[model samples]
Target: MLSTNSTAVAEFQRKSAQAQAALEKVRGRGTAGNGATSAMVDAGGRLRDLTFAPTAAKWGDRIPALVLKASRAAEQDAIAQVQKITKPLTDDPRLRQTLAETKSLLSAEEPGKRRPRPKAEESEDAYFRNFSPHDPR
Candidate 1:
């Protein structure tokens, strides 16, 4: 029979491979300057595709700027995609750290940015009332 240590190692290796495979399925795109141009990339940081609006061609002289913007966007997009793809693995600290590192690199927007959090429906005191010893059973 295999030792517990070996089983754990085997499981870790399996999970790592699964995480990488899940990342491969994540496709991300970054659009710049109102989506006039965009870059597509997979979570692996490999460029996949690009898009340009008709007017974008006129900015050929600014290709370097455009490329930089698109790359940043692509990186951010990839990070987001990878996060979603690997949600299941996030319970593992090592996996979560790996994903967070990518997100830090992209400076991805805060998860709560778009929507303001709703006010607490119940206050702490009220929450305790439900289980408080002071309350009669």
Candidate 2:
């Protein structure tokens, strides 16, 4: 029994090490305002670098917003990188089952605390029609 437990623990450690290595390889980059601003984030979603074009400061009051947008893009890029690397592991049946179980447990609520589900739009066309003029679609 002790041997079995020890083996399981060792396997877990090995998997954990592999995951850490993959995460370390993750590098996310984000750009805003047609390359006017940019940011890079690591696997842990920590900012690694930021750059701005010479004209970036001319935007004045919009500088903060531009920086925020670029930062968000970088964070998303990092998350995508991590997801791409871990896809195989995440696709495991055991992991899926565990995630589903955990989600259900977390979503459970008392009788009076249940939230109403939002109704789906009756027409998909109506949803698309609401798109802004600037939308590519």
Candidate 2 lDDT (Cα, whole model)?
Answer: 0.78
Question: Candidate 1's residue-wise lDDT over 1-137, tens digit each?
Answer: 23644555566678779888787687777877666788988887788888888878778778668877997889888888787766655566654455566568667677657644445745655676678677785
lDDT of 2 by residue, 1-137 (tens): 44654555565557668888989988889988877899999998898999999878777888878888999999999988888877756665554555566677787876568565555543655777787888886
Which run of 10 residues does model 2 get worst, by summed lDDT? Answer: 1-10
| Alpha carbon RMSD to native, model 2 | 19.4
Give candidate 2 misplaced runs (Cα > 4 Å): 1-16, 94-137
For model 1 the TM-score comes to 0.51
What are the clashing pairs of model 1? Answer: none
For model 2 the local lDDT of residue 44 reads 88
In candidate 1 the C-alpha lDDT for residue 126 amounts to 65
